[model samples]
Target: MEYDPTLPWYRRLHWQVLSAMILGLGVGWAFGLPAANAIGWIGELFMKLLRMIIVPLVLTSIVSGVASVGGGRAIGRLFGKTMGYYVLSSMLAALTGLLMVNLIRPGQNADMGAAAQQEVPELSTPDSAVDLILDIVPNNFFAAASAGDMLAIIFFCIVFGAAITGLPEKPRVVVTDIFNAFFQAMMALTSGIIKFLPIGVFALITKMVGETGFDRFAALAKYFATIGSGLTIHLFITMPLLLIVLGRIKPLVHFANLREPLLTAFSTSSSGATLPVTIKTLREKVGVSNKVSSFVLPMGATVNMDGTAIFECAGALFIAQVLGVDLTIGQQAIVVLTALLASIGAAAVPSAGVVVIFIVLNAIGLGDNPEAITIVGAMLAIDRPLDMYRTAVNVFSDSCGAAIIARSEGEEGVDTEVRH
Candidate 1:
């Protein structure tokens, strides 16, 4: 296929996203909340459309990727590399956030009294670790699909993929080809839907900015600044350091290659929603092999959440500080471990961070009081912006994981030296 340079800039995905963000901010500021509210349906519709396709896309892509990895041995290697990177990066991110929050103490000056007035929903404590494990298995695929439980979907995909691997050659080839075609069709559909992303993003942002206003921003200024600062440090400093030292890729080139997907993830605030863009950027711009990008990005979207993990850790500490709860060394260790695991367990959905925050609070004994949960609610008022920032980090880490995995797989010819 020949490159088409005559396409209008607005027709391009990234440019559209940029335009939406700019226009959204402008509209929100000018006409205020009511005007922003009028267009809220556009963002709602966009999210619904994305949610509609998520289950099938995740299922088909993961199953096809796993099946293509071939028998038990290849699957083992792929799993090891993929999970290893996820676990390590997620832990590092969690720790990074934890360290920053501890040092800065963003909530130290905040009043918990105002937060106490907000009615906090009573959260049920999960029975045990075993119960959590049991919950991973989907009793009904339809139920899981309806609920958009990504971990459950991932569980199903792995098993289904393995089954595909065991089938006889003729049948396997036919089944694989069918899935491949389905995956492509879904991608095409996603592309068409994303053409409206600018509209959706504009609506979403305008609503957010219009609703919150400058007053709320002033109230949570410190907390937002803390999380934002942490994300910036990780995205610019830590991640790039890893890219250069561990991945052996130039940081600027990797960032340049990742511009499109990073922006998409930032705008969407859902890594799963940004998968198509991530895959395309890795394959086309960064020159990762399809086999690598296809395998890594989907799995990373599920299990590899460096950004969310970081937010969870920082959020936990911020809440703890506001509540005057002093976490011990042992308790901090528990936060690290739980946040890492919780990141893996978190569903790749819009409000998933709230659920994960609840889990983290419960783990650290902060869930006993309704007041603590209310404090989290205060955090939620500013969560959307921070969510976008963290999501960009999430997608960046995923791409880095892909590059590292691709190198290990001997598919490094795509970018021997990452371009600036």
Candidate 2:
């Protein structure tokens, strides 16, 4: 937690990460896919290490956080606010994407029919909404944790953590202390892993740039522009406004503190993979308390997917445009509703959005079209970069939720003072 005052800025973590990104971009551009593929293992190792800690970190953090609050009412209040914020933010994000895609018309007048010749990636559609609700209660808690089923883990932790509050005082104190200790230990472990972040970012970004090069982007120029512009606006303009206005926080200061996690999220392109870093940064750097961060952040990873919602709505509309199918207003409303629900259930992994996007397509009557399949196949070619952008947005939104919720809970320092 301490820094050497004498160390030059160039040796600092933020500067190091920035330098890694620049160097990675240069190397990837010069060497291309072979270099990217060769060096990818370094990034993968970092991701593995991050993922290794997530389940335990989430379990202990949520348990400890809820127990520390000492009652179900406090935890319930937090949950209500957190979920309300997520729904509102997701609606805005999806609406923004819907509006942007309509204005840009990326698929209008395009000859993307040849996409039919490409093979579509196999994807498993999520079960019915009721089934998704049922799945939140795992058949076995240990199995859910081992499989890293976030929603199931969250449900179990909330129940277990709440139960701890109702125990006799002596046992409640004992149990709470144990979970708190475990959470702290996990944070310490995460801090050690975070030291390798710059190297991991360098490798991951290099591989991404090298493998997909710039030429492919030109082919999907308008599609990329629409999604990219929408994401940028949502992340930089919309979220910051929400923080400053609603949360009473300094958006720039919070953003400065978030650089490490955001970079890691972009590189890994999986919020679940980056959850440890996100929780660590929010608590250590952004000055959010463990109570708020532990509860808000883990839940955010599972359901507060502003970026995925945006991508889902826009991507569905894009495919429709390419196929020359105009959806009615009622149908677009279905896209919005389905996108929100689909994003909540979407796996927090790179390109996972594409897999569930078919739900939106199917809802709008385009799911069975060969032309729709063709466009999806074509879109897959450039999904990685877009995935990275949206993942960063996803992480950023989660952090914002934590900070806001912390402030609402009367936790100070985040809105009034800068941590770093």
Candidate 3:
């Protein structure tokens, strides 16, 4: 990649986004709600643009890339490894949170009072395991696409891509060429949106800081520390170990390659919004093939969710502790199980984990507790920063999975150099 000689050094995207964050903090701190409201539209536009590209990108990228993987056995092997990694990573993440929160006991010895009744959204938790499985197969592609049903979309794309290989040579070539071209075009468009990302980040951070202020941070310091600590362990420790042990790759080198995607995830606070960046970084910087990245990264965004799993587990435990509810070992096990499943269906957006935390609480039989509602409400106020942190973890985990899978498949694109 070449830089424009005439452009100032600070005009670079990384520097520019960093500068925007600083300025956004100033605006939010000094001007407060008025400025945030004024600049919020750009943030909304930025997210919309990112979301707009996801469906087509995933559809084309997965369909084209999977079509290239070839044959029934190859597809089966790839699918098995991908899902095996996802489930393992997710469960480990949940367990990490469960253990950390139990150890830290952030909500223990706390002086939490009854909060004024806030209207919580009605949660539609998955009815059964069978329902979740059946939901993956969409009744109508158009409806699924419009709804942004990622699982259904992925399911359709896998079947569609697999069928392409069975077609006659002429038709297979034509179809592959078409989807490949479309996927490339979508990526180009995503790159364009990424250019304006700094401004979007500025707007988002400004709005959040301006409206919420920092008071909640002081109030929820322990809970914040607990969540942050768990995320840190998972991102910096557990995930790197996975890469080193299972993938047999250099964890530090892989971490170095993830700079852009991790930073983007933090600023955007939405894995879905940061999907374009994650895909690009994995392919271009980390040296993963489009085949592995296209399949693994998107699925990770929709399903893997290491960060969200941690939050659900920890957050549920925190709320329970605050409510003076001492859950049994079986109930704690239920928390782990529920968190792992709830995270799979979590919306890949900011604070979505907290929104669904009630499901975990409900699973462990604490949903109807009045104090639980109060605790969750208080936690929600301080959720923005945690959301940012966990979103980055979510992206980091996805990138790691892509790198590991690509290595296992013997794709030669990983840049193992650790930049100073």
Question: What would the TM-scores of all predictions be?
Answer: 0.89, 0.96, 0.94
Cα deviation of 29, candidate 3, in Å: 1.4
Candidate 2 C-alpha RMSD relative to the actual structure: 1.8
Q: How accurate locally is residue 412 in candidate 2, as Cα lDDT from 0 to 100?
A: 79
lDDT of 3 by residue, 353-373 (tens): 887898898898887887788
Candidate 1: tens digits of C-alpha lDDT, residues 153-234: 7778888888999999999999999998887887788778766777878887887677765555566677788888888888
User: lDDT for each of the candidates?
Assistant: 0.78, 0.87, 0.86
**Evaluated with TM-score, which candidate comes out highest?**
2
Q: What TM-score does structure 2 among the candidates reach?
A: 0.96
Error of 3 at 231 (Å): 0.4
The regions of model 1 sitting more than 4 angstroms off are 1-12, 113-128, 413-420
Instruction: Provide the lDDT at 335 for model 1.
Output: 87
Candidate 2 residue pairs that clash: none
Best by lDDT: 2
Native-to-model Cα distance after best TM-score fit, residue 407 in candidate 1, in Å: 1.8
